[model samples]
Target: MAYKSLLCVLTDSDFLEAPLAQGMALAESQDAHLDVLTLGVDRSQNGYFYAGADALMMQEMLARARSESDDIEAKCRQLLQNSELRWACDSGVAQIADLGRHVAMRARFADLVVLPKPYGPNHGTELEPTIEAALFEGQAPVLMVPEDAKPITAPETICIGWNESAEALASTRAALPFLKAAKTVHVVVIDPPVHGPNRSDPGGLLSQFLSRHGVRVEVDVISKTQPRVSDCLLRHATDKSADMIVMGAYGHSRFREAILGGATRSMLENATMPVLMAH
Candidate 1:
């Protein structure tokens, strides 16, 4: 499976038509094949085996989830089947309990995913749980959009939070396909006032590298004087009207370490826009 295609996510209702449209636009801009997926999560995957789900009831529950997802999947496909799109629905073979995992597994084959912003003070309370699962459990870089947004190329002003870490590197690498394709790439280096040097310097280094390939690069060196770097990035992205944020996910082995130096944890907690994260 090629990890170069785009995946669009949807709910059973049309309240988020804007995100669907943007997802389509995102897919077309990158010359990626588009796959629209709608999910109706039944039981959490955890409950199905170890100690929760009733085995005899599993098949029935899975069937109902598929039935619910089917209509939305069909509607999404109809809405996006113009000449430019090669679209399909995954309401084909699935189980509700495993939908999140399946989406994550299949996302390995996709270059990116266009997801509706799972949280907003204004969205219907009904969609929250399903969205939450995708945010944490789905293993893809999500291009989350506003509920009312129209289709668009990723913002010309792109902000990448550069840190020397695996998740960040994965995010950087995943974003390269887009970065190389973007009209403008802004590398923002948030500097700690007391620091000697920021480790990665991704914006500077990547800008120079992409310039050789004809991409227009801009660099914004910021001093992390106010708020933490994570919050600063969010503020910068909003202030610049940055279309997307690219950054690494920071993680540590033990429970103690995970809390001590996890920037990804911070971003995931506070991010309010389409953030491309790779872990």
Candidate 2:
């Protein structure tokens, strides 16, 4: 019924404090076990592709990576030592592509996975792919904390982007812990299907289900046309002063979204608030 085990991925020095603090706070609140995972990118294969490149530069890069990973692990240990909840730290070194799989595999045993927004492509972090892997491969709900996400406060108001898809249902169920504690739960359905099981009463089924759990649920349908689903969801969240958003991770193929575009990708790229997503 609640998060009993939470995984928080630590990537960069610039982004560590927020997620670390947020994860610890959530663990404390739920009386859950917190696992801090620090990642170090493996670049040993780089020599094969860039045979002519300077070996010294690659060595320096690997050393820096190790140093940063150690720093993050140390910080996590220090923080965990002062926390009341059970906590542990784990560190690993893997190639960029392999790292995602590693994290996803670890996430499989967790109740909730926490990650930061992907670093900008130009920034060279390559942590974005891990987000997708964690959501889809790990088959778990992901709580993405924005860089600006401060120390966690229980969300009083939460907005759910509902479409009645399996993805949406998974996210809603995964978010029950938060929804049950929230003062207000708004199930916003943007442009519901004209004819389907939910056509007649979009959000009706889910709203009732939540109410049964003692959640203060409200259903809101945005009948007005909107340019993009993400825009509508964000606008509704803003209007309601929502602290967090719960929604499906990707309703369409990741490749198709990358080639075209999708709501999940839009939210991941632009959401200013914390987003809890599941695939």
Candidate 3:
């Protein structure tokens, strides 16, 4: 009752290379399909993200873009050749690139997506157009990768941010495959309300659910006064040496989710490990 395939969408950017490798390894471990998709967002395209730029900006951007694209393809091909998996790349049609919109379009068919976090330089934010599109427009589970994601340990452990919400339940169900692979699993819920005598049930039905599936589950109860679940979860992950994070994504809508106003957004922006989220 778990996913049998994973789509690893790429756009020839260096930022995604290592994360793609990590995603591929994850897919292989799960016995899933690894589909590599590319959208060469052409700087020359009149309506593309690069179209409204200056002349010099366009030139260097395209050069780096092509170089990154070439590197992504060659590396992916090499990795696929040596591994026992089905992997391939999609390089868009002709010279046109969909950039963020393209990636967003293909996101519909993927069980989960993995991409690199953007960094701003000299006051310029790395929140490139594509990242924005995927986070907001792409209606799929996406895993954002930090800079140093290569040594991401599989056998260590992972944490799931839990709450009584649809998104949370979806995230938990989708994360079963990964949780089953971890050496340890923690289903962390923070700061439950002070109970009256009528509240007979404890706050760990989710933990019991995973336990039924054979996951090594641990429950944590923290301060309700802190008012920052994201900070609490991140600290917990660090303390427990969690390699990946599993949490339900609650948002009013997809477009508004990327701004990441709540603890979930904070966790995603500040996550040291790969985050698995489903809308």
Candidate 4:
């Protein structure tokens, strides 16, 4: 029920400090082992066009990638050398399109996957695919940490975004450890259906289920005041001064969510707090 092994995946050096710090703090708190992976994108995978005319350009790109990887690995080792936590640092390069699978392969052996916020002012969109791969392919919960997030040994209050879908159930189950440790857990449901099986009482079943596990749980059924469900959830969590939010990722198809913009996309792009998600 507790995280014993944590994996931190870093693609570049732009927002490395926050995730590394967070991973180390969590590992120290849990007395667990931490593994840091510095992944570089291989530009030579798509250098077919430079076979004869522009081969030197491709070589230069490959050399740059190697240099970046070496720099990141050195930085990680320097930061982790003085720490008393059990940790290891490794680096690898993969094609941009296949980076997700490579990350997922390593993630399969870890209890929890720690990653930088894929969509934010401090991060680029390159990590989005890797996050998805870890969530779906690796079959492990993913924690996305913001660049300016305060270090937390454990969350005091948590909010769960509920929709009664299989994905939501999976995330809720995955977050039981945190819920059991939190002082209060809120199962927030927005605009519940009027004709579902639990129409008479929305979120009550979940509250009861959590209570059986010694969690101080409550249910909040609120109307959707904002255009998107994610906005309502974030506002409520902020109002409650919750330290973290746990919810399912991509309730809808990824393609549909990307094209039409679902709650998952909105939360990934705009959330200021740490979000733990599973598929």
Candidate 5:
């Protein structure tokens, strides 16, 4: 089957346009129903804890947030109106953290979720929490669009960063629909383990599995020493003119922080093409 339902998360941040356009384009290409979830902050609830002075300042903040939210909502509606695709729009008013959870809950019903790649450190807004929420809470594959991405289209060439991790398997399975449709599927293994349970012929098993699904699969083993695995993966994708990169997301424990795996973070920061990840 195909992606019959797609969820897109929108925010009043700098990274909105590309994902908005891509989401609509993707939904149109797949003939899928699109759901757009926009987030707004509601500070009214903070009134219970505020004194006279604090209450006045809080009211100003709330007013500003409300105005911003309204404008963003209108913009989203206008964008959707311009598109002929089947779409629905929903908005939530909550703290940013809770807003992410709300989006995640809605994402559970979707076949795929679309999001804008998080800005690099020093770049203003942060959206990784939202991405994390959607991936973990929704338990779904996420398609992250770069700021300069072209209008979405069905991927013709796909690169799978193979490591045989459970997350990688989940990503591959989630990407099967695209792989089966692609003209070429490259399973790229970088600096694979020489001998281990996970290294029983790196990429061979996955290639075979994909071949059985009628995909034109090829296994590529690259021996690179300098750049990181994530860098090599991106290089391979570029060299092959891949339209999409499907891989696993890595994460670790961080007290009150969303600390992502090195490879996953690099891919999110440096990828010029759409990266599909599952954790």
Candidate 6:
């Protein structure tokens, strides 16, 4: 019901401040231990180019990676030095292809993983693999913070995107602590099917369930007037002045979402506020 251990994933990028600040703030607020993992990834090397001088090229790349990792670790320590929260900093070097598994190994021990938003102007595809690993391989809920996001000690108003899928259920369960602590919680259902389990009531069942858990909850059934369901959810959250949005991730296959665009991908790319997601 509460997060006792937190993991913050970082890379050797300029987008480190947001996730670090968010992680520390959450740890201070929840009275939890914080672990920081910085991954050093060098994308300048190609296997085809190192035909003759493989060993020397590999050695040089590793040395550069180690220096970057050390610098990142030093920066993390400097920022966390004065904080009273229990914390630790660690770093590793991994090839881009192996980054996901590397992060997943450490992510398995944490209650919740905090990560950088993988898509946006401030970020590239470097952290996308890591996020997928933390959610799917590690089987942990991930709180993604945008590069410009402000540190949230505790969210006051939260919006839950309800779809009655197993993934949504998992995310809602993972977000129970935040929902119970929030001043307001909105269960937003976007154009529910008239022939399904929620035919009689769109978001009523979920709202009732949350109310029993001491959540100040309400149901909002909105018509899908927008082009995408994510747009509707984001608009509703913004209207409600939500500090964070809680939703399931990748209800469809990752490859499908990547190629055809799904709600999860849209939310990840467009959400202005922090997003808590589980898969």
19: Cα error in model 3, Å: 1.3
Off by over 4 Å in 6: 44-53
Residue 265 CA error for candidate 6 (Å)? 1.3
Predictions ranked by lDDT, top down? 6, 4, 2, 5, 3, 1
lDDT of 5 by residue, 121-212 (tens): 44424377777777888888899998888865768899999988899999999988889989999999988887866576888888888999
In lDDT terms, how accurate is model 6?
0.88
Badly placed stretches (over 4 Å) of model 2 are 43-60, 119-124
Candidates in order, TM-scores: namely 0.73, 0.92, 0.76, 0.94, 0.89, 0.95
TM-score of 4: 0.94
lDDT of 2 by residue, 1-279 (tens): 889899998766667777788788888889899988897775455746676768787777778778878887887788788767888898866667567688888899999998887744433455677788788888989998888877554799999999888998999999999999999999999877788787888899999999999999999989646777998999899999999999998899999888898898888888888999999
Displacement of residue 166 (Cα, Å) in model 6 is 1.0
lDDT of each: 0.63, 0.84, 0.66, 0.86, 0.80, 0.88
Each model's total of backbone clashes = 2, 0, 4, 0, 0, 0
Which tens-of-lDDT digit does each residue in 1-279 have in candidate 6?
A: 778899998885577899999999989988999999987876554554667656867888878878878888889999999989999998998777677888889889988899988886656456788899999999999999988899986689999999999889889998888899999999998888988976888878888899999999888889998999999999999999999999999999999999999999999889999999999
Write model 4 residue lDDT over 1-279, tens digit each, in one string: 778899998887887888888889989988889999998776455644444646677667667777877888888899999999999999987667677788889889888888888986655455888899898889888888888887666789999999998778888887787889899999999999999998898988888889999999989899999999999999999999999998999989999998999998899888888898989
TM-score ranking, best first: 6, 4, 2, 5, 3, 1
- Tens-place lDDT digits, model 3, residues 192-235: 55573312433468777888888888876656545668888888
On the 0 to 100 scale, the lDDT of residue 24 in model 2 is: 85
Colliding pairs, model 6: none
lDDT value, residue 57 of candidate 1: 74
Measured by TM-score, how close is model 3 to the native structure?
A: 0.76
